[model samples]
Target: MAKRWTAQDVLDLARLYQPAGVLTAAAVLDVFSPLLAKPMTAEELAGRLSADPRATAILLDALTALKFLSKQDEEYSVPEDVAGLLAEQSADNVLPMVRHLANCLRRWAELPKVIQTGKCAETGLGFRGTDADRADFIGGMNTISRPVATGVIDKIRPLKFRHVVDVGGGAGTWTIALLRAVPRARATLFDLPAVIPIAGQQFAEAGLTDRVNLVGGDYYTDALPEGADLAWLGAICHQNSRRQNRDLFTRVHTALTDDGVIVIRDVIMDSSRTSPEAGALFAVNMLVATEAGGTYTFDEYREDLREAGFDEVILVHQDEFMNSLIRARKT
Candidate 1:
């Protein structure tokens, strides 16, 4: 028999945000950056962070208890492995993603009002703020998407294609991974003007600059570059309504060569739509963050593809992480 949740489980769930809050607070306070050099007592850390000593002590103890930091003789230090990923100055730092999640937490707090009004909160969801924030968000995407790139590529197997068009490809992480897997294949990455520069930098760093053609435009209004044998849309459809996706698919169809393939990487639901718990929860996230974004069933994908004049729509992969793959061909 399967284990069941008890009252204690309910309490645990209720307090689940505590650890996340602690981590977010640490990120906001820039605590990990200071600890990268050496461990410090709460007083010294407070001095470095310009925080209240007593309050800093409390937060340090919480971090130590959570294993994000270790306590040794009153000194608090981030673990060596974690320091590289959490420190703001580290090359591999994911502080931007952490900060973005911290921002998401604030938006999620408005869920009740959003449900009551059937509208998003005043803040709105699209990328807002200066160029720095846009860059950070794109970098955060790179950090989060890197780990899953291999799994997604494995499922899609783009190795056979001579050229691929990565639509709405942020930071070119997937495109880079594809190039690494298929040495002979080249790619075109399309994204917003602001994002293309970042993708160019990433491509340059990966020695993929010569192999990729970077195009910049709003995918909603602009025509995609033509003559690609494969078009990849990673985590794109969930942000649009069925009509919008159909229109986009039609555009993509026009951009591809004869018999070109289209691959979609996203959370694909069963007809019931409830079995994949993550997809269901992500639908809620879409509700809060987008005007019409939500998870779609495989049937919905097939129907949309058919309506857009594509054939052979089929699921290539499905997993609990909501990283499902669907493929279709234009003949």
Candidate 2:
């Protein structure tokens, strides 16, 4: 049923960026980190962050109003619940993803321009700059994927392999999940050179460092590490065009052992490309972020996989977003 919209509803929708901008700006400024230790006056926080005092006070008050922080007297502190997810000292912090969203918000603001030009939005390195932005992006992948990976891997139960290749395995989240799922199996995690160290740190932290070999190279230009019977491409397909995915599948096909299998984890759109609302929205994110990258339909994936010498393509699982699974076997 289509409900009628009112002037206030439209105004509310237009002003939705207010809270998002406040929270993202706070994340970029590390607002919650110091507050985790102790309550502080806005001026103190401003001094610590080298920010403007009045602005800091306004942001802190806004956060308090949002219940993300607690205010007592003239000081502010992060609530324990909020701190657990935003404080730098917390083990379960998701600041990386928050920072990445800040980056995305910047690009999304240029959506109208992208629509007009058929080009990606021009964005500067966010507050912490390029290296930090890249690290946060990779870390954000772990932040988002770590919780769901084990569950996603569960769908491919009875999956036994001596070795699995995790292509573009950002920060080793899926590799860790896969290795844990198959205790007797090992893995070769392949990603860009800058990302290998991050994945290495994660592998070491997971105590699976010795079980996974980290290979650093561009999948587009370099040879994939071979000798694996199974390949896992988690959350990677959406960053590529169909042509690029076919090329990537061809590489995976060559790198696999005979009769090997490949599994892809990404958003699989419906035939109309608009049913899974999240996938459609993500397509717009890709439109602003990549030259030629967006969600794909199952038929599109099947056709691409077949072109890469794979057969018996199947959608093992269907998810409204990135948890969908597609499996294919090398012929």
Candidate 3:
């Protein structure tokens, strides 16, 4: 005999689930950004945002309960991790990626059509839906991607590559990180032409303009610059299908100088397709958004890199998340 789940038990289980908690966390984290460098009471925060003070109080309390904020009496402050993200506009605006889901989720509702057609909805680059959405999309993406930049530097500190290319580098977080880490490093951020002006400004602001290069064009369609010692494919591969990923890598191999290496940071699944809830949910996101995009198992990627002519492929770990750092050396 087995114990049956009661209606209340089922509802409770759903209420206590991870997605509900993560969404709540992301929202709370976003609330901290505009208020960075200044602490405020709930009433003040509510006033600044044109929201209800009582509601803001409740929300701040909830965030405190989640350990993302610290509250005492009526004062509230973001946690160190939350504040770190809020301090940098270009770090990785996780808020945008989260908001990209509002209309984007509608595509999931049409998954039946997508499945039948074998095509996922194209949500276009970064921004979405409205003007405010455009701002949020860019902000959120940069905020969320800052960790990848930090993680790349942390993982590859031992390497002394002089010339690096950040494939699909968008706003240049990876290039900035590598240059800051290795004073001798000179790096290029390869992205669409629309992305250059912004990336140039970012590197300049970081005082890294001298060591940085902005090369704008689609990596798949353009010629990769030769003699680069390292390249990064951070968070970009999960946006394409298997064949597209293969093609991207083949193009990468062609761009590398002999003995060059490619460093990829992405949400890699455990080989058994278990654990790392973020990676699992990100798979759902890719399914809902990309016709070909979905996070893959490391074993799958290793094989792909090998097929693309990398002689040695190594997988590393991120300290804060289950995402894997993949480095493949061209023979």
Highest TM-score model number: 2
lDDT tens per residue, model 3, 83-111: 65443453543555566555455565566
lDDT for residue 95 in candidate 1, whole number 0-100: 82
Q: How far is 271's C-alpha from truth in model 1 (Å)? A: 1.6
lDDT of each: 0.87, 0.94, 0.73
Report the C-alpha displacement of residue 134, candidate 3, in angstroms.
5.3
Q: How many residue pairs clash in each candidate?
A: 0, 0, 13
Could you say which candidate leads in lDDT?
2
Q: Which parts of model 3 are misplaced by more than 4 Å?
A: 1-6, 12-98, 101-118, 121-135, 318-322
Error of 2 at 318 (Å): 0.6
Off by over 4 Å in 1: 1-4, 50-54, 72-74, 123-132
Per-residue lDDT tens digits for candidate 2, residues 247-266, read 99999999999999999999
TM-score of each: 0.90, 0.98, 0.71
True-structure lDDT of candidate 2: 0.94
In the order shown, what is each candidate's alpha-carbon RMSD?
Answer: 2.6, 1.0, 5.8
> After best superposition, candidate 3 residue 99: deviation in angstroms?
3.0
Rank candidates by TM-score, best first: 2, 1, 3
